[model samples]
Target: MWRTIGGMLGTDLCPNNIWQYFSWCYSFLPDGEIFYTFGLAALCWAAWNCRNRTTFEFKKMRSPFDVIYVACGFITYWAGLLMGEDREAMERGAKMLRGNAANMMRICAAPGGVN
Candidate 1:
């Protein structure tokens, strides 16, 4: 199931030479190819989980909580990607996404270390 969805997504989002995208964009990751593979796999799993849960029909009024949750998820995923493989960067990115920009930037841009 995960493979099927991953294949479809790869085909749509990254056709021939998909590794190129990861290698070029995510140089921070030791193995961009593997990271992308796992990321897509996780996405497939989440999609399946959502499918198994109750489905929402023509939503009248969108829930703010749901919107916020989805936005957080999006932010987390993108920030994690952008932060590369640096533990400090990743942590800072997470904090930033959680509305701690001041602290995140402070820690992220720290000269010696991250605290």
Candidate 2:
């Protein structure tokens, strides 16, 4: 997937189209897209959904951690589809993300830390 065959005679030479870039980058990765890369996708999806909720549903984001928490939930749930070390790794990563977000939330909640 990184390189096309010498069969490309009519196409302009390119590093990769923006659309294919992410696919090529994630393809055949040892870490697998399902864990880390998909986590990014999950986070983005969570943010988009959260934005929609706030805008259309009139929901309020009381803290920035709300997005992170939602993302962690998504990734953690999807990790169940994996097995062995991949699953473990994804869980650990999700746990770390949750922990860090919580700490940041706590700091923001503290006096003079955020507001």
Candidate 3:
């Protein structure tokens, strides 16, 4: 059975149960991350290709601190989840990353902006 195969994978990273399905849907839903990564890349590309001083000034540039924070937080949290004993803790960790990532993206994309 699929459950048996999942158990054999020896780690709970795949959300093997129904509870995990709900958790992943609410938490690790990959769409947001995809959008964030692409959006950042696009912004950087547009900035580099533009001749506008205001858009291209390094001194006036926003630091990537918020993005870094969210990235590090996601890595740390997910790594911790991999070491966790049960689905609940993993779910909680995933939710934390999702929330942090969302907040971080908002900060990065705020109009008139953030640094």
Candidate 2 local lDDT, 1-115, one digit each (tens)? 1112101112233334545545543553345555546655776788899999999999899876788788888988988988999888878877867776766566657577565
Q: Each candidate: what lDDT?
A: 0.40, 0.64, 0.41
Residue pairs with clashing backbones, model 1: none
Best by TM-score: 2
Q: Model 2, poorest ten-residue lDDT window?
A: 1-10
Q: TM-score for each prediction?
A: 0.29, 0.66, 0.26
Candidate 3: regions farther than 4 A off: 1-85, 112-115
Q: Deviation in angstroms for 87 in model 2?
A: 0.5
* Residues 1-115, model 3: lDDT tens digits: 2221123223335555556644544454443432333323433443443325345563442434333334334444444434434434444444554455455556657586456
After superposition, candidate 1 runs with Cα above 4 Å error: 1-31, 55-115
Ranking by TM-score: 2, 1, 3
Off by over 4 Å in 2: 1-34, 112-115
Best by lDDT: 2
Give the worst 10-residue stretch by lDDT in candidate 1. Answer: 1-10
Ranked by lDDT, the better of candidates 1 and 2 is 2
User: For all the candidates, what are their Cα RMSDs to the real structure?
Assistant: 13.9, 11.3, 16.6
